[model samples]
Target: MNHASLPTTDLRARQARRRSLAFLLFVLVALAATLGGPVEPAVKLLDESQLVHATTAAPPVEVAAPMTIEQLRARVAAVLEREGVPGVGLAVVDRDGVRWAGGVGLADRDSGEPVTADTQFRVASITKSFVALGVMRLVEQGRLDLDRPLRELMPDVAIANDWDATSPITLAHALEHTAGFDDMRFNEYFSAADGAAPRAALAVNPRSRVARWRPGSRESYSNPGYTIAGHAIELATGESYESFIEREVLRPLGMPTARFRRSPEYADRLATGYDSPDQPALFRPIWHAPAGALLASPRELAELVHFWLRRGDRGGPALVGPEALARIERTETLPYLGPDTNYGLGNYGDVSHSARSRGHDGGLPGFLSAYRYFPELGVGYVMLLNSTHSLRAYLEIRALLFAYLTGGRAVPPPPPRDPDPAEVAAITGYYGYESPRMQLFGFIERAMVGISVRPDPGGIALEMLTGGGAALVPTGDGGYRHWREGGTSVRLTRGDDGRRILVGGLTYFEEHSYAWAKTRLFALTAALLLIQLAPAWALLWALLAGIRRVRGRSIAAGEFALHAWPAAAGLAWALLPLLFMHMARAEAYTTANPLSIALCACTLLFAACSAAAVAEVVHASVARTVPLSLRLVPTAAALASFGMTLYLLFHGMIGLRVWAW
Candidate 1:
């Protein structure tokens, strides 16, 4: 028994040593990579010489009557080439049926397979329109109620509604994206495989199920909300969402090639998606299929568009009554969020210069598609592409096609709103919205996408610090309309703290002390870089000490402790990105993951280490043992590290458990 205990204790000791060595090695490797040069991405922008054949000339001012198919093909091809899209499928629909259908480029660049009218492309968010139609069909059949609270219908489903009694989530709210649910988190979005069922996919990450605000109070685009709606449809009809939609909606509407699941028969016809003309993208199926997972040929999409143009009538089985169709066409608006322009039930409503248009545009990682119908003109258009780079090209094609069909010029640009320099100046500052839902990474999230309001010609420009910029036109009601996109506006209000709060398009940005926070981040980054040099510093110091000892000089052992603790703290800082890279690749970077729990622990350890380092530096500084110049660097490093740690703590990044929230 004593011998057995001795062996077990030895094994435990060995395991502990192994773990310690593994951690040390990991830290060393992470520091090495961090010090490595920046990584270069695969795709690079093409130069002007490479774009010579892409037809960068201006579009023709007008086209002759009864435009030939060759003319349309040439124009589309030019746009696709110019935009670097690998392939595109187009369908032109009129009152009778699909008038013309064709494709312009390669479906599979490797195989050199040409895209055709029947080649299927992921329709992305356009799948929402189909799901909306399914819900309306159920409503028409008296199987589901649009206004009824979703909790009432699917009692088995778990949804956290803080406004339970006051405003429960309704079917309408889910369809219109006013359900107050957070958008599907990172883990939920990329973790699910193609075959995962709707409810199973949602179960992977349930943190997003909790309402971020009161249901129906604001409109936010939520993919999970629509998946819930689809689940509700299955519960209501006692049929799988796909089967019901296929039989009642797709079959009746003559959209035979349109379906959620990828069939083996159509695999060859499916266009290969690409991140760029040369880079093939993986076919990642959307977990929330009801929101954006349908693959359809341009002609198939055109058929659906044609049916909608006829207003719930396809001369066969009526999908929904005309009244229900009208309701679907009606756009929803909130007092603070403004009108969700052209955003109806899975559709968008808009008035161009010549006709009223209703349709939806969809974009995934490697695909973009648009389906727009002008009911007044009795024409519909479907454009599907395998690359997202084609979006600008697709928009231009839509505008040009509309102009040709309606015999009118492109929609006149909205007149610019008069400049209010005073108002602009007053609002010119940095604003941030920290989402309580983004539990662990809220600090980085807020910092990355903060808003900057700057003075512009019209009134002011609201620019996302990360990238996108849009002009804001004064609406004179403490509101401002988006310059390009009508029906979308932002309302500004003064919070009790005297900070201005901007409410727009399902998001709110409160004026933040961005300057102070930004300064701290810059300081922290500089300190971290310097801290990464600690290993080199230690090695040099050890070498010099050994040389001195060989020369009969004594080395001070106490000096090791003075440098060791701070170096250890610096090592922790270097390890952060390494841990993040591991999690991000697995699509488990969200707070829901166990790895995120480890990350929070690391953050706490870092904070403690930083504090200890600061205390050590202060003690040395007071003792006057270290040179002032040497102390200055370590002092700054420790202070910056402490500030960053505090920042993370205050912003709820440390020890945050999103699942509990």
Candidate 2:
């Protein structure tokens, strides 16, 4: 009876298993049918002839046809929607005149007011071009000379230059940003009292007036230098820079709306600038108006661009003579700033894609603008945006417009030149500039953000220790072009002291020994890592000691203090910057803020604590009270922290007083 029952049960189990597998197969077949089968051939391969043909074939044709006004408008609207730009005003000018002029997005998002062609916006640094026009007008009148020493013309203007005996700063140097002056420091720029005279505004930071290098030797962008040039205009013409520019330049070009300040007529029509959708930008008076502070509508700015493209061939009123305009358009060859680009009197010159273009870009807290003119093509563009987001959108649009204007011919980048290994090695090093423009903080910036140039297979790569980086490619000339940034380049030159000087965009950096930079970087990295990890290690050690105490062992007071100091120092170092950031969010943190004072105090205290911790670890290592393993970690941490503190001290950050500078 038992044998029969077992055989029956095994036969029933085998049948059930077969039924289950059959059902699973049916479900998989149903899923495959529902999903649909692949449409194209799954395994297609090209023959040898097809492969060769594909490799040798020309590239696909690009969209080179000129876009209609409606098409351009649609594209701009798409970009505005995608970028979340609040408002933008645009004007495109051809040889005949404005091809199209209009606005996109909202002038006031809350009010639902659409931006119009006549809506005014802050043009920021584009003001430099107008100021340059004023200076050139004076030059044509023989009231000023570009090459004349500025001090000779405006004796009252106090500028200190140590690199040269004569303190030679010229009008051209000031206009071209080659005066060797440092940029206005945080305090000088933000804490400047409104309604101050030009001289008084400059006096706000006397140290910034001093040259960081010899005048006309290197190009460094300096807003304060432009202000000084504006003052020179006043001295030469006995008229204010703004008044002269308005009467002679703006009025002549039929751009009466283009002025340095908010006039009554254009006040209500001004676009509301924004830092973001939620953050409204408040008005801050620009003391250095000549550097950046122009307000104009897109149409008015296009008028100014038209004047340049015509090369002073204004049918009615001319702002500058043909000869002066030529001088303004010609790019300088001496004291080079870039390989394919140069700063003209009040304009920037660039040869990219085999086309030479002149224009300027402007930026401020909540506004960004650009005006470019391709003289050969007799085409120009003006872009004004009320938001800083998507700052590069205008540039991309410019490129598209240029391609269409050029009949779709691709303007390839300059051919890369083979770099000499020896030359590359000679230039590969760390370079730093003393940013005396930032005053006290400038010293700290120089130490923390030095430029590092490393040799590479193609050429050299230059990087800022603080953040941004660029790849350098040799440009056939004895200079290197930024592989991606077409208009920017660097030249290697010798300083007055016979040391290697790297001349980039608007500043010069003196080369530093690789050995020195490497050691500093290693010490900095080690210290940063140790300080960041101090609190975690300290807590772990404390926990372990507590476990020992629970097992009937107690740690000495000396040992406890040794661990405590590092934790305390680390917290202080980390918390201070965090606190500053918190204040910065509230718009309460500034160079002159009391929080800066507290930061300085905490930094110095941390350094002191770090020094004590180093001593304690050294003593512990010598006494051999702790085991070798325990001693090693503590010793390394202490030494790293101490080294960082020393570096900070050397850079004037440990006990720096922001207000004093």
List TM-score per model, in order: 0.74, 0.80
lDDT per residue (tens digit) for residues 454-544 in model 1: 8878777777655677776676645665554333345666543455776553355678777865765566567667667654454565587
Residue pairs that clash (backbone atoms under 3 angstroms), model 1 = 342-348, 342-349
CA lDDT, candidate 2, residue 498: 73
Please report how far candidate 2 places residue 254 from its true position, in Å: 1.8
Please write out the lDDT profile of model 2 over residues 582-606, one tens digit for every residue. 4444444336566667666777877
Per-candidate Cα lDDT values, in order, are 0.67, 0.66
The TM-score between candidate 1 and the true structure equals 0.74
**Residue 333 accuracy (lDDT) in model 2:** 27
Would you give me the overall lDDT of model 1? Answer: 0.67
lDDT of 2 at 106: 85
